[model samples]
Target chain A: MNNAVLLQSVRFIVLVLLQVTLLNTINLSQYINPYLYILFIITFPISDKDNRLLFIFLSFLLGLSVDLFSDSGGAHAAASVLIGYLRKPYMRFSFGVSYQQQGQKIAQSPFSQRLIYISLMILTHHLTLFFIESFSFANMMYVIQKTLLSSILTLVLILFSISMFKKKQ
Target chain B: MRQIIIFIVRNKNFLLFLLLFCFSLGITIHSHIFHRSTFINSANFISGGVYGTVTNISDYFSLKTYNNRLIDENIRLREELLKNGISEIDSTVTSSTDSTTNYVLHRAEVYKNSYKAPKNYLLINKGSHQGIKEDMGVITSGGIIGIVENTSANYAVVQSVLNTNSQINASLKNTNHFGTLSWNEKKDYRKVQLTDIPKQANIKIGDTIITGGMSSIFPKGILVGTVEKFTFNQSGNAYIIDVKLNNDMTNVGYVYIIENKDKNEIEQLLETTENE
Candidate 1:
């Protein structure tokens, strides 16, 4: 019904499609699969009046869609929800009270603040996804390496996409 | 009632988060325990269909490589045919002998393959309708591939040798000593491990490994790998040999599913003997 809602909806569809069709198939190496779909949750607009329940619900659906196409069972969904649940706190910690009081979207924040927000979000998501998928600590170093490499790739892709698409606001 | 309502409203978001998180974790646990839960079944169907289409498009790009492999295999087969003579091969085919004729081979293409995971699986384009069943041995002309684990109407999932739980009977080509073949869960796609060979068995680097024929699944002397390294285990009674597989599990495209004709009868007889 509104411009923001329409744009966000389009973004969700495009990100999921890109992830399953192209990003999931790109096996640069065993440990460096780039998960660009987390871009949706990382950039999801948050404000005091934003409905936390709706945010997480949408995150779950977005993840399930990717998992359905990638055949990862529910690992993506769980990780997405975990990040979604933590998004509010992480945003507050990264942006501080002034940005919240001004009701600024994360994309409009300072470069350093945005970097911290995206990196933390991507790292948390990748760690949760990899660990739950492995479900073991036997390969702790392997898991950590994968988490780090994939997070870096995801962060780079998210930043590039934001730079290309997000209009200065 | 008033206090309860206030508390619920105050913590509703956290409660909802917990609920959804548990629901997803439940799905994960269910799929892991059952291995073929409804969630996985539907997910597999959707993902398999999409991957099949994607592969169809991408397969053209690799046609040259695939064609080269096929030509090589064809030349080797023709050489064998010429050396052994047509009649000898024909007689073995017509008669049920232990040599090659006892098993019928069906050709299938690898539709989806994963070598990076600890529990890797391969999806092939043949299934029950094509006479494929569980425990049938799958191989490429290069060497062993995996075993058929589950089948749908027109698709089958293979538990690859790269998987943690995979164990196949393998033996050294030059000797009678045999061992169990498995994976070390290492990141390399080209190597697997062979364990349980007796320490007394003389083993050398580059010794060929092949199927032992002791199991109903794979026949005797099918090429598997070569001994890359060997060492005595801490027990000092057995050797652990690292094998470099001939079939590159990462790049496998064409495979043959070996169906032993007398597998059912043999299994039944063995069961009866055990009962006695």
Candidate 2:
């Protein structure tokens, strides 16, 4: 009912739409497709200590949505869940819990920290996704080429999105 | 019962999120199993709606280049008209009474495409209504795209050469040594795996490969790709030739569907033998 939730939902719809359609079309070369939708999972409010569950749930959805949209191999699901599973540790590492009301407060995903973690997550996610999608140990050079190119574009978009959120906040 | 009801009502949002997440997982898990699933279909329907809107916005930016391509093709045709003395009405349906000449044309556009997977499929704009049918060879101006896999009233899904299931009978155009074109889940070279080729074949790095005449799906002499590398796979008798496809499926917009006149007869014979 609140404006914030409504706006977030609208943006989520927009990101999901763009992710499946426009960005999906931009193959950039066979291997260099940039997935810009991971931004949504990275920005979800840390609900509680069980935010891990939420992140796991959402990351799986995000990756699966991408897998469905991009016709990505099941790797997107596995990778997204991997990142989701890892988010709790990374968030704790980034936004240390020694501060006031750490237990009482759901750690806010800070903008800069969100960028760093998202960048790492996207990099690992895409690399694993592409590598597994390729399913070749011999094609390392080619897979690396795809991973680096896609990571660059993903990071740029992630940075731009974080900055935009910062501006609004 | 009242206490339990109160407990559920108190934590409804958590329950709601859990329910939705479970539903999404169920849908995704079932999507790949069958040709159709309501959940996958719903995802397709929703994703399709969203994709359409976004494509419309971005396709606007592509108009200039698209127009230029059309204009250039038009000018080239006009030049041919000047030299050969042709009529404007016969632009698309080109013909000559000369039996030696062979040309067929049918318009199709890509509706669904994939490049991320090793073996990708492309859904095209033409179908049975437009005379497009399964195994009708599809190609772009640059080179081979794929063979029509399945068809509906107005569309067909092309078994893109990138697909893991694709096994086009192809070979070196220069030497005429042929093999089967296939993919191995690697996105690179989408151009991977030309199997059943003889190890003794005169294949070289950069040798151009084309569909062999032995196929009913594609006419001979249509380009497949250039050989990037070759080696003996588990099957020692056959060489595993890596090929780099010529037509870039990533940006393929328009294509032409080629139907062989004798395709029906060939398929019928193959089917009977298959049943036997």
For every model in order, the fraction of real contacts preserved is 0.37, 0.15
Off by over 4 Å in 2: A25-31, A49-59, A98-116, A135-149, A167-169, B1-105, B112-117, B126-136, B149-157, B184-193, B199-208, B226-244, B259-265, B274-276
Model 2 over residues A81-156: C-alpha lDDT tens digits? 6666665556566566542245422224555655666667787778777766655588788778888889888888
Give each model a TM-score: 0.89, 0.70
Model 1 lDDT per residue over B28-102, tens place: 777567664425532256556766887798789889989999999999999998998878865446654446667
Instruction: Return the interface RMSD of the candidates, in order shown, one decimal each.
Output: 2.3, 5.8
Residue pairs in collision within model 1: none
lDDT of 2: 0.67
Instruction: Tell me the tens digit of each residue's lDDT in model 2 across B88-160.
Output: 5464654565321343678876666777655466766566778876677888766788777656565566677
Q: Give DockQ per model, in order.
A: 0.51, 0.24
Off by over 4 Å in 1: A2-10, B1-8, B36-38, B41-44
Candidate 2 residue B50 Cα shift, in angstroms, is: 4.6
